[model samples]
Target: METRQCGPIGRPRGFDADEALERALLVFWEHGYEGASLSSLTTAMGISTTSMYAAFGNKEQLFRKALERYTEGPGAHLAEALREPTALAVATAILTGTVRSTTRPAHPHGCMGVQGALVASDSGREVRDLLVAWRDNSYSCVHERFRRAVDDGDLPQEADPGLLARYVTTLAFGIAVQAASGVGRDELQEMADAALRNWPLT
Candidate 1:
């Protein structure tokens, strides 16, 4: 006897994964990782818990994917900023980009990577650690770029790449926090500009 071929699996995932992921990213952006409940996430994604799990594994896994989307979307400026011709330009671009990304109208305020996991409970430890690594990787990239600037004489011989990187990253983070706290984009941009006025801080 010959067996009949089955059409496929369950319901055809009646939603757009890309669009759903974007919705999830906004929820995570608006609320910290721990703060975004399954209900909220699924509601925002316009899916059920079963659909979320079936499509993205679990909450943490969904969060991981959302973070990836954040990096590629709003957080893409860091990579582009690193390509600026001079160290000062790099610093400027990073800060400017941070301010803009964290304060866009019709979008969640603040950096997701910064606000997503600032504090975590016992169960959220893994997510907290993941964000730490995300931030550390960003710092490392900036440090390396600044180091190259020092070697190229773009920065003075006395300039310290590590210190400079820390300074810029710190300002970037500060801008994010301020943006989250209702700080205006213009004011933050002015502050960022002043902070870089005396660049290559000896």
Candidate 2:
């Protein structure tokens, strides 16, 4: 009888790639990129280091995919906010969304993209830069949205879209930091409401 060769061993039983990525995302959200060690990630993903490597390439690549998932999942508010009928509404949605997302009861208490790479070591420099670029892209999108608002006469001719976008994003990032510091959602929402009472800040 000819000996039959066994096929390559498959992923460990009960492996769910999406669920694994979600778990990894939570780990990174709580621990940041550099702080999330390979051991921790694999453990959270419920897989061996070898399995992690085969599925996600490496730690850095896993982080990239986690960030992408975060953008589409928890960080989707920005895209949705941009579609509001007016710039003020868009800003409101953005701030409200930031407050809610950063303070969710069962999730990490901060924005992953904000806290993911605030300060990375030499090995984490690429991730740090990646976050910077990610944040800049968000700013650009808001700036362009506000510019369109100006063109549509939704904002005053003197309204500076760049400045407005900066103001909003800065506030949103600040809210994330505050949430991470244990600030309550109600208080943040109140503050956000107060801040936007006079929209298109001069």
Candidate 3:
């Protein structure tokens, strides 16, 4: 019996894993999971098939890593926004931060998590679920923050925290799509500011 070879061919010639992942993330962000091929990923990452396999295991694993990078980088502001003392401040921060992140000129125009898989396919269920889970977790943070705000008199007692959370998150997802559609950062920021003006008062 003979042992079979697995993954790609040879060892990684040379490439910065972070940089490569960033490139791959952009490809995925722009084209989505199903649209992005291994060839596109390798070309953008400046690495060979074998190198990507050696470093990131497989396409799915590589996408997971890229998602991690996205959350830690562009999406990191959500953590701070959720910790805001007032619900109004929390909503403002989330919307404004979303505008900034989605419109960053250096990277792809939208958020990797939100815009990456808007139209999920049957085979991409796992990755799609992961994105949804991340979005839901972020929403929960907003809900918790608003609940605390209501208890502390920052938000009206009758206001629904879940609704508030969903509203702002919906705005965020919309902003991502608009940014990806070529909306300017200033335009998006203005839209975000207008949305915050609709924030419920105590």
Candidate 4:
């Protein structure tokens, strides 16, 4: 007897894994993990149960991968904005950009992560923890940037970067909620601009 190669050949699924993950992510983003049933994932991912299990493990594991992709893909821009030269610009970009993205025609319902968290229950500990951690880390990153701005004399010496960072993060999340609640883009932009202007920069 001779050992034989298993499954389809020819570059080993050049279009399968990536497409499946993308589809699964879209489903999870659209509907929270609990809400996105197996049938939904399989239908959206275009993969059978066996294939999904073999490629992405169990449901929880697959959900984690989807969340990771979200953070690394669609959500990456917000992290990038934290690297702006000044705290004011970073805050402005984070808040205003978020408002624009959330209220855009393509994503008018608001942020996937924020919406998912709101629908989660106590049993959804992993998902809740992931969202909280992501938000906390965002604050930390922005706080460090604010600290750099203070050190560079861009912001007032007496300004507390830590508090400012938390405030900015809060404002961003609040704007996300407002967008979800039917607040228009102009109002959110004005709010963000006024918030940025109020930052102490003596």
Candidate 5:
């Protein structure tokens, strides 16, 4: 009698995929796309070269998966920020979350989405483009939320949701850059507080 298996039978992965990808995420977050070598990623992820490729396809694909993990896990506050009750609350959530995430000691300082591929090489244009698209989509989501706020009378009807969205996004990106440059969390939070204090309101 012959026994059969459901999936392709290969050597069982010696690493926990979620944990390895999280390690890879941190490596990419710290080093950026062009800067992170396969050696560095695989070493940090505790996987061999062949295993890394077999598990995640290639470096680019691995980066993409790690990035997805980042936004879904450590970076999930971005999506949650838009769920605040009022426009001011939403802005506050975003700004506050940005400072916290960017300046936290556990993860690398700054945003993986914003700084991950800021200066990629030509060969890394695809990776950079992916990051850019993710950021742009996030901005669009914020803008739509702000637009709904206006319709719901949370923000003034005359408020330009697009401009407002740009303002908040710009502030978050700047905070990320500063945090990456060793700025303290308190300083960035002060900035966020000040920005919300002067918010355009009804």
Candidate 6:
């Protein structure tokens, strides 16, 4: 049996390697790395084992590619939410959006990265590191927004940007977990709103 090759990260030449990666990503996202068996991946990817190995290198590499794809997809939106004019506004939007997005009827599996980390034993060091990096990056993005808000006078200069950023991310993470655990939209929105109202005003 011939192995199928995964195409380039963005654009492939002849075959839709990128598309295959996306399919594989969805399977992993819904099932988690451990739950997504090699057979399942091949079936989902529509490629044989040889091709899967040739294109993705290994299960680990495919998982990494899926993470990359997620960053390019969902992470882009999250980053955009951090750009709101007011820090509090941006924070609220992000928090609410996260809960809404996670709890949407179509996406019931929660965050792929968060699931990967919480399950723990299934992923390797690299996968864990990638999740950590994403979390750290998210906090930094929020922190930068807070710093900008302070400069723009929306927030007080005395507010600790780092702590504020961490808080925003922490709230977002809590929402993700809650959404995963079947939290309702109305209730989640209330929690998100209260969190925004508590933002340091000084």
For each candidate, the alpha-carbon lDDT, in order, equals: 0.95, 0.94, 0.87, 0.79, 0.90, 0.78
Worst 10 residues of 6 by lDDT: 116-125
TM for every model, in the order presented, reads 0.94, 0.93, 0.88, 0.83, 0.94, 0.84
Residue pairs in clash, model 6:
3-50, 3-51, 4-51, 6-55
Q: Any residue pairs clashing in model 4, and if so which? A: none
Tens digits of per-residue lDDT, candidate 1, 67-182, equal 99999999999999999999999999999999999999999999999999988999999999999999999999999999999999999888999999999999998888999999
Tens-digit lDDT track for model 3 on 1-202?
A: 9999888786745778888999998899888887899999999999899889988999999989988888888788898888877889889999989999898887788888887776688988888888888888888989889989989998888999999898999999899889989999999898889877767833
Per residue, candidate 4 scores C-alpha lDDT tens digits across 28-141 of 766767888889999888878888888889887888888788777767768778777777778877887788777877542566677656657777888778777877888888
- CA shift of 74, model 5, Å: 1.6
Whole-model lDDT, candidate 1? Answer: 0.95
* Error of model 3, residue 194, in angstroms: 1.6
Q: Taking the tens digit of each residue's C-alpha lDDT, what string does model 5 give over 58-93?
A: 999999999999999878998998888998998999
Q: TM-score for model 3?
A: 0.88
Indicate whether candidate 3 or candidate 6 has the larger lDDT: 3
Model 3 bad stretches (over 4 Å): 1-13
On residues 12-117, what C-alpha lDDT tens digit does candidate 2 reach at each position?
Answer: 5458989999999999999899889999989999989987888889999999999999999999999999999899999999999999999999999989989999
Clashing pairs in 3: none
Least accurate stretch of 10 residues (summed lDDT) in model 1? 6-15
RMSD of each: 3.0, 4.2, 5.7, 3.9, 2.2, 5.9
**Candidate 4 runs further than 4 Å off:** 1-11
